[model samples]
Target: MARPTVFLIQIFAIFGFLHLGFGAPISLENPLLRQELDKVGELPGQNFVVNFTHYSGYVTVNEDSGRALFYWFFEAVEDSSDKPLVLWLNGGPGCSSIAFGEAIEIGPLLINADGKSLRWNPYSWNEVANVLFLDSPVGVGFSYSNTSSDLMNNGDKRTAEDSLVFLLKWLERFPQFKGRDFYITGESYGGHYIPQLSQAIVRNNLLSKEKSINLKGYMVGNALFDDHYDHVGVFEFLWSTGLISDQTFKQLNQVCANQSFVHPSESCDEVLEMVDKEIGNIDPYSIFTPPCSDLSSNRLRSRMHRIGRVGERYDPCTEKHAVAYFNLPEVQQALHVDPKYAPSKWDTCSDFVNLNWKDSAGSVLDIYRELIQAGLRIWVFSGDTDSILPITSTRYSIDALNLPVIGHWRAWYDNDQVGGWIQEYEGLNLVSVRGAGHEVPLHKPKQALQLIKAFLAGNALPALQLHSDT
Candidate 1:
């Protein structure tokens, strides 16, 4: 199963990544806006220079529930009007896409350590197409609900329904994007979100001929496939990678077998604790990279960094920087966040939403099958190093679908060097970012950009480009 690349995957994910710092937000003198621009504006301390424009605010998904979902939109670097629209959701079932997607992962800028500045991310997805980062499910990030019960009641089914409604209502605000080619992308738990929302869009498109979203396809990375496979892959990866002892791995499998991974039993938790201890003080998200060693600076805001590595060059301190930047009063006001929710600090992941998530479909394989049959451009990519939902686990789950190989497995390249590996199946495509963690784009921006661009263009990963050195 292994294919040799010119360079090791771990080195690319670590020393090869880029690291940037924050600058003050430049106030837009005459910020351009579409006719429906409500909270159209620039960040107060966003000092990075850019040609494209961005808009942010809320869309009420449910009036009776009084729940509003917040969103931040960035136009493409150039010719944004003609570019396709991509919706990005970060999975926590409760994490803020704004906190993760926008601030740290694929968004336009990475927050500075000062917590009051912004820096340009050269590989931001907005470079290719219009990108929308949504803080979904009422209580995540800047989104909230007046009806307290709505916060307590979020699940896969509800999130899918609300997201569909959010998309429809959001279109009303920017009707120009209504008929545009649209795609949804997310990670981790978003595996659930992408499929369910894509399925909803398909049903909606069939229902209404006049007002429908022109959804093209979707991509999910390092996603939760299903409980059994996810757990199996998690343990297997640890054992295979030599992170855990053979005894610990065997005990975990035996005791945790047929048990809930989400809410594991006492014995299972104990076994996991042993597994965690065996793995030791390394970042499980990206095992080879150095874990964030600084915690005292901003404990509350740093939680997001706990699960994964930070931006280019793998700045171990990005979590603290993001926490500081997002918590600034000026930044909050600039984003048009309601003051009522200010007392509660911004979080990368939501404890309430994660704990209260009401539903989890056993496996999205069925949904994948249905969507592939529907002829949607389905793509699944994985960060080869993610232990939580390892590439091995994802491979097992996708293999269950038995998709016929359209293109044989081969190494794909970027900048004329091997970036990762790709295998195209009849209805879907699977690509692996050699050294990335749970957040593929954060660690391997160049490769991730290439992956998304090919997916959006409905083409295969670019063939190896010849060079003088070669």
Candidate 2:
């Protein structure tokens, strides 16, 4: 088993000035702000990094009851004003976007062999658009609150509300980017996060004419969109790939097709057991470990399992590494985490952070429908080899949408070499990354970058031939 890695927690300190009533206005003139501004420079892949100097001391969700906190990381090309801002979140219901920033997509540097210091990535996302990676809701990453209750109870509703407040505060901090286009993108559980946040943005847009956040589009990669389709797809994929025996496939098909079946019941136990065994045997790196050995029992006890242990507690304001490499003396000094490698436990996904607010009724497909109706562009891409949220599951999810196909499934190529396949439907597009796993950018950076570039440019993906079935 891969050694456990600590989840790095990153939080921004609110300071400078207060505008009161409306919210706190961060002063760019603060000394720490000045220091951060001075630290701004070119990161790997020629991307410009500006430690967002704005302060968000306190965000009040309501005058009487609701409130949350957040911090932002902004990256862009130097002196470029017309680019769009893309808000990126990482799923975990508790994972930090900073983790995604450092390990997979963008930021500035990568953790070296020593675990500390920076390395370069030539294909960072900031090359095309301004990116804002946030640690949000309240306790994930660097965001925090004095109220202990705030740390323990949060769900999708609270997440969406806090995210909206953060966006508003962000706009207030960087007024120049207010009128610019904004897009929400994330992976894994973020598949849920982006849509919920987008829906909230739309509602706010409709409610307030004077102040509207112009949300352009949203995308999810290897995201959990629809539970029913996603679950079924996993079974089909295992069978089709010859990972399961023909007899097992037949048995599973019959069980799934039965219309009388209901969730959280004992009748489905045998099928679920088969699934757990197959999944565990096939891919040991299940992002969220299965709750029980019996699949039916796991599904029925999903709520209990989902609320698994929250790891060691550390101050949100403190800089800690989720992985040992990040906490190395060299890393701490280089990354600017305090105490320089002082053996601190990392919480990549905090169990203490409440996510009970996510409407149990809401499915990934439900959010997708809302986005389509709201006229928001959507893209769902998958890394073919990812067992966690495989391409088959994504295709299955899209099929249920019954989205009208604008273009048939065809190959996407680079340098005349077959790269992957693309299927265009209305405002939504689905593409596969050849040879990529759960983390596409990390696995196939060039292909991933090409796809992102084409999507951002609003161009149809180029056609390449599909791999022949021998």
Q: CA lDDT, every prediction?
A: 0.77, 0.59
Runs with alpha carbons beyond 4 Å of true place in candidate 1: 1-40, 295-313, 468-470
Report the lDDT tens digits of candidate 1 across residue range 93-186: 6777888788888998888767677888989999898999988787787888988888788878888899999999878768778799999997
Error of 2 at 404 (Å): 1.4
TM-score of each: 0.88, 0.73
Predicted structure with the largest lDDT when compared to the true one: 1
Best of the candidates, TM-score: 1
Q: How big is the RMSD of model 2? A: 9.7
- Going through the candidates in the order shown, the clash numbers are 13, 16
* lDDT of predicted model 2: 0.59
